[model samples]
Target: MSHYWDNLSARTNGQHTSEEFESAAYRLVVEQVIYYADRHSRATYWLIEGFERDFREALAPLGITLDVNRQLRYVYAKPQYAKAGTASVAQTLLALVLRALYDEGARLGQFTDDGEVVCDLVELEEKYRLMTGRELPGKGEFSELMRTMKRWGIAKKSDESLVQRGDSDQTLPYAVIIRPAIADILGEMALLRLAQWKELDHMPRIEDTESEDDHEVTE
Candidate 1:
């Protein structure tokens, strides 16, 4: 066995093997999070609990925090300060909107067995308009936004495997399943920033924050 394995065994008291640790770590790292309710990720989610200490230790040096929610049955890595210079302002807005939707669903007890909140395109459009005073993005941008949501573990389409199905290259994926990870990803801080969005003279740059949008938008 490798050095990490040997040490991990001793540290975890042999409750979980090195391979289990590796699997759990890989999923947490690759997916940015893991939830027990997600059928494909259920096993790894429990494994993460066993190796939580090691995960925190490994992530601490990089200024990332590993949070495990026992009630929610999920684990995710959160950076102290992150500059995600990839997703656009519109995309970020959509993500925040989805997070708000999840909150609403939670309050209303509208959740799936896996704790996901479901909504369709029309409802999303209405919420977007009500929240941001804007309609959904253009078709091309909508497609990209959906891709961003899934890539960042925010939301997923019902037909997730085929997000853009029609010949128009537009995602009419009316039905979407908002992941529970959004709560951790956006948190209350990010949502507060989003609620104050209209007051800002400048828009959120592609380089916004992770747990919070610390990058102050300026003209």
Candidate 2:
């Protein structure tokens, strides 16, 4: 991916005025940060497919490792943090999707015939657009961002043979995994927003947080 970065920058004019670039960069940052936060994680082949190999190599200084096989791709750390960082939108979306998966009790592995798996990038972004009433970063940016997540173990890809309808060339369709650590991070984010929401006049306040109560607080 490092080799392509120059071309990407040249074509996009350094992505100075591009929301797509900004979003993609944000995703990359999130993926990197989350990967460091979790010492060990792995990815499937589908998860890392769209990501650039050079990009993964750049992350090697940080103790990130990539393992690839015919049926799967894996990435993780060795109980330490890497000091490198880069800025990609694919990474951010990867984190967001993984957080959602953690909340929903799914792993960042392959989607199976008997089980639900990570959400597809297209469908996931479409949902985000619908919720926010705006278009998301382009597909290229999204792919890059997911590649970052796949590298960090925050998310993984699903095997395609389980769900694909036709005899497609692809073996696995990518999906995000929301790791336990990632879920905690996401929960913290949600908690921050919840705190912010409570500050709003329109939001319902919790009376229990204000004073002593006879019983434990309940939602």
Candidate 3:
């Protein structure tokens, strides 16, 4: 994470503001980007929370909404089309859809009446199968991955919930946006593919830095 932050800082030339950093965090995470914050400083928390706030804000313009339970500290995102008073939906549309599916389980009494909706593992796998038209993974493997995703906020569970079925407790609310963060880099790879397929120079060309020999000759 730290390495990624360093790269991001260099790319931005140290011009990123708190809000920008937060928004960037969302974009990075949504794109499955990894970065490390200043572990030794208070900056880490600021960066994490700021990014979350900015992420939620980003969804607002896209007509998405989110709801955070102050008491339970649960966060929920959904489309803003019909739900006007709900919170902003700054996450990608793919994420929004997954969250809604998780929400359905919440409304269906998966948790205690007051508990929030985390995603149901079984349902999540089923949804994944449907989306990709592929076979789902075994329960154990999928559940473990889900928990890890939840911890990272790459995917999240409800903060509070009453266990409905002993085993089937929560529901999933977000899609894992980036499948292969390295293999499928967001900007460069996507742009390059577009340029090739579209047969146009859509991608911006980056100039290479001067070599040591060139620098020495110039000096």
Candidate 4:
């Protein structure tokens, strides 16, 4: 028990007891990425910064490792043993599209002062066409994927209704706040591989020979 833990316990009336806090920390790493800008990330970040040894020790037995990027100001989990081909073709394509849009938004100074990049469905679709020479996912699939991305802290939609409707015209540029977590999700090596794939005009297919090492935690 550290002084920090003591203060946290006092603030939360022991509701965030050590066991409870550790469980919450582990859940955060497993379920959602921890970003400095996300309000919910504060507690997990505090736990990692203040009780890193305890946190790591607790997760070590589960074969999950914490990847803390100080420069990026975020944390995510990686399995010690690689899982095979976790990303479906649609998911991989969507991630690449988002990464491309993130880069474009940054280059155009479309990011907010707080460093969130905002992109709309229309822009995403156009970019997808340009990059892949293929149509974007159907509306239902696209909306579902967006919801999944939102859950994983990659992006946040401005209007839930617009997402549900899945009509780009009706939504008329529904903006998604792209968080810094995208960089961590895609990473440098993944992006390089995607670039190579694109140069070779390799269309993403379900049967594409993607190794576990080439895939990231899209699900």
**How does each model score on TM-score?**
0.73, 0.36, 0.27, 0.68
Better model by TM-score, 1 or 4? 1
Better of 2 and 4 by TM-score: 4
Q: Write the per-residue lDDT of candidate 4 for residues 1-219, one digit (tens) a residue.
A: 355445655776765676656565657656657777667677767666555555666667778777766665666776677564465556777777777778778788887754678776777778887876668889788888788777666777765434324434364546777877787666666555555545555555435546434344433
Ranking by lDDT: 1, 4, 2, 3
- What local lDDT score does residue 124 receive in model 3, on the 0 to 100 scale? 57
Clashes of 4: 0
Q: Best lDDT goes to which candidate? A: 1
Worst lDDT run of 10 residues, candidate 4, spans 160-169
lDDT of 2 by residue, 39-84 (tens): 2322222223334464365446646544333232322223135433
Off by over 4 Å in 4: 1-16, 69-73, 107-109, 159-173, 196-219
RMSD of 2: 15.4
CA error at residue 77 for candidate 2, angstroms: 8.2
RMSD of each: 6.7, 15.4, 17.3, 6.0
lDDT of 4 at 158: 60
Q: Global lDDT of each model?
A: 0.75, 0.42, 0.39, 0.66
**Model 3 Cα lDDT, one tens digit per residue, 1-219:** 445445545665577644545454454334333323113323433444444554455556666554433332233344435421221111122233344444455457554333434444455567654543434556565456555443334454443433445565553443332211112112233222222322322233112324222111000
| Comparing 3 and 4 on lDDT, the stronger one | 4
Q: How far is 21's C-alpha from truth in model 2 (Å)? A: 40
Which of the two candidates, 1 or 3, achieves a greater lDDT against the reference?
Answer: 1
Residues 1-219 of candidate 1 have per-residue lDDT tens digits of 256756886776777777777667666767887878778888788777766887787667677788888876788877777765445568767888898999999999998877789987768888988887667898788878888788788787786532444566655546878988898777687678666766552565334534544344211
Considering TM-score, which of the candidate structures 1 and 2 is the better prediction for this target? 1
RMSD of 4: 6.0
